[model samples]
Target: MLAYFGPRGTFTEQAARGFATPQQELVPFDTVPAALTATRRGETEAACVPVENSVEGAVPATMDALTEGEPLVAVAEAVLPVRFSVLRRPGGGPVRTVASHPHALAQVRHWLAEHLPDAEVVATTSTSAAARAVLNGDFDAAVSAPVAVRHYPLEVMATDVADVRDAKTRFLLFRRPGPLPEPTGHDRTSVVCTAADRVGALADLLAELALRGINLTRIESRPTKDRLGEYRFYIDLDGHAAEPRVGDALAGLHRHCQHIRFLGSYPKAEPGGVPAGNDAFVSAAGWVADIREGRGA
Candidate 1:
């Protein structure tokens, strides 16, 4: 079974369904952490949760769950285009209040301000939850996915309400740690590194990858929660750990970092889709390996 942050009509459920075969079951949990925790406890085979959105950046709950407690390895990822609608009851009165997940509210902030400047906005656990609130007569309108309108007795007062038309969210499928996926050339490795409380420590950590010609795709620092000033870095880099140079960079980081957690390496989502292999990166990897083994100058 696959567990997702849902009540059946969430974008998370939509992402999870993409990976489910007819034989598999999809379960819904109230929160992102709840879904992931179900995977960690073996209640489900995998967890599908949103990790990042192009507009809102990182999802803190998902990040914290991955960074803390027993580790879960990311096995795959899905990118979904986000488009929200302003939904209301069929005969509802003027929208005095608007409700939605905080991220959803933020995505449509400009639209909301222009259309309903005085409407009081409230937060919910998920967009589907916001739809449920509208059903319960708690709010006159909700900013949610179009799917919510079909699921609940709500009408689309307005459609395509996101601040940006091309906004997208990246969701991850996580499972218990096992053999890492074989290198795909266009793969990404994620790790969490805790730096020592000293100057240049972050720069030094980054230099390990930079010196090896390994490219970092993304990096963000989250509070360690153990202390006020202490922080842990979440980094996404361009190559798989199995690659010689990438492996070398990670090993070098281990020596300087207080703790290093390998999240996983998986095929990166690309425009034309993940290629079987990149001839250029493959040849460069071979040259690097040869130099390391004293076979090249």
Candidate 2:
């Protein structure tokens, strides 16, 4: 079974349906943590959830789950273009409140600011549940996917509700303790580490990878729990650990850094068929290339 973030009308559900094998059973959950926990508990062979968006930064809950001592491993990835619209009941009665999953609501806040200016933003457990709320007539409208509108038979009050066109979000496919199938060439390794608080400590660790000709892709600093001024840096690199340069860098990094965790090395997103004019896609590819080859001037 494959677990996904869903109640069916979510973008994650669409991602799982698009990338998964037809025979794979897609289990839906209210949160990425729940889906990831299900994978860790052996309830599902793999779990799919969004990690970041082109427009937004990282999904903190998803990152925490991956980094927080769980055996769940990121095994593959896919990107979906996010198109949001406002769904309402027929006859267009005045909307009282707007409902959606927190992330979905965040993604469309600018639209809400402009169009549904006075509508209250209330949190729902999932995007599909928001659609369900609107369907049940409690909410005047909801901000959700086109899939949700079709699934719940809601009317579209406005199309293209997100501020940016061709927005995209990244999804991770995870499983554990098995031989990963050979990649389709594009690949990435995600990791977490901490450096000594000394001034050059972070630079020294990064410099080692730079000298080894290994790319350092995405790096974000998340505060270490209960430790003031201490952080864990999450990094993504282009090549697999089997490569000499990458392996060497990890060895050197391990020596220089106080904490190092190799989350997983997995296949990267396949290039073709992704939507055009997406800033996030461009940003992700640049980061990937940097990690793969250290592409910096």
> Which candidate gets the maximum lDDT versus the true structure?
1
Consecutive 10-residue window with the lowest summed lDDT within model 2: 272-281
Every candidate's lDDT: 0.82, 0.75
lDDT of 2 by residue, 12-69 (tens): 7777877688898888887778988898899888888888762222378778888775
* Positional deviation of residue 29's Cα in model 1 after best superposition, in angstroms: 2.2
lDDT of 1 by residue, 56-84 (tens): 23378888888888999887778888888
Which regions in candidate 2 have their CA more than 4 angstroms from the true location?
A: 54-58, 90-98, 101-125, 156-159, 226-230, 270-297
Q: Give the number of the best model, judged by TM-score.
A: 1
